[model samples]
Target: MPSVQIKICGLTTREALDAAIAARADYCGFVFYPPSPRTLTPVAARDLADRAGARIGKVGLFVDPDDALLAQGVEAGSLDAIQLHGRETPARAAEVRARFGLPVWKAIPVTAAADIERAAEYREAADLILFDARTPKGALPGGMGLKFDWSLLAGYDSPIPWGLAGGLTPHNVCEAIRATRAPLVDTSSGVESAPGEKDIGKIAAFCAAVRSA
Candidate 1:
């Protein structure tokens, strides 16, 4: 299998951003959802993103956000890509792309084989696809740190690049890569000391595992 591409999501601090950069993560995700503990203001996101520079891809994560908010995020000039982590339709994804002229990644929640079928819809709408664990009923959409069965992705294929996320940590990342052979993998709570608190050591360890996979 090829080496995994690591994306550290929900970053809120310069320390964490620096840690992610030093770890050489392929992508750094900034949450724009207000309910999420890792959420960042547009200004804050821009600052961290500016600090990240060109060392990694900056991803703006949102959950069914309005076009105005999305426009503000894009105008901030910190993000290279947008990740729709909500119940957005394929048309909405396309609209965001067309309006902003930025790459789009639509996140799909997977818990069963049927869930995998949803990937087909976003394949044409997004430049990339993110497979994350399904948020339980009555819960927030994402950043819950939950993981679904990796075996479910064994035969998954799509024209767009795909990423595996949720509950990924230093210990299980290698196995997750080996099982799903995901070219890209993302983590948020898994590398944190607590909810919204990123641990630099864990970040480094997780990156090391990804590089060695």
Candidate 2:
């Protein structure tokens, strides 16, 4: 299976960021969307990102943000990459990557096999693809810890560097990796004690689970 990369997403506190780096996470993600409980202001994210330094890649998660927010994330958050978790078109993803000069990761909400097939639309435009569980109508985009069928991705040929995301926890992450042979795994609410609360022990355990898988 080679080595699996892990991203601890929606980190809002310095403690969580420190925990992620201490646990050897491959990427540390910050949410920029205001509707989320884990949302962080650009200045706060920048402080944490700077503190993290180059030890872990810093990723900013956005849900169809305008250019103003992107500017703040770029100039302040010091993000290494941008994650678009919205209804962004392939062309919109490409444009963001070109204009921002940062790697663009497009999140595809999967509810069925046909949903996974839609990844091909961003094959050429996005630098990476993330498959997350599709939430109920009127729900927030992601970070809900809602999991899709892991088997939906079994033996699937992903168009770009890709990952399996929704509802991953330390208890079941290994099964997810084995089921889909995921190259990367991302988690937000799964390791939390409560909404926006990152548990250090859970963070460490989740990373360990990925390595063991």
TM for every model, in the order presented, reads 0.96, 0.98
Cα-based RMSD of candidate 2: 0.7
Superposition error at 129 for model 2 (Å) = 0.4
Estimate every model's Cα lDDT from 0 to 1: 0.89, 0.93
Clash list (residue pairs), candidate 2: none
- After the best TM-score superposition of candidate 1, give how far the Cα of residue 161 lies from its true spot, in angstroms: 1.0
lDDT score, candidate 2: 0.93
Model 1 over residues 55-77: C-alpha lDDT tens digits? 88999998999998898777663
Report how far residue 41 has shifted in candidate 1, in Å: 1.1
Model 2 poorest ten-residue lDDT run = 70-79
lDDT string for model 2 (66-142, tens) is: 99898898777788999999999999999999999999999999999999999999998999999999998889899
User: With candidate 1 superimposed using the best TM-score fit, by how many Å does residue 13's alpha carbon deviate from the native?
Assistant: 0.8
- List all candidate RMSDs to the true structure: 1.1, 0.7
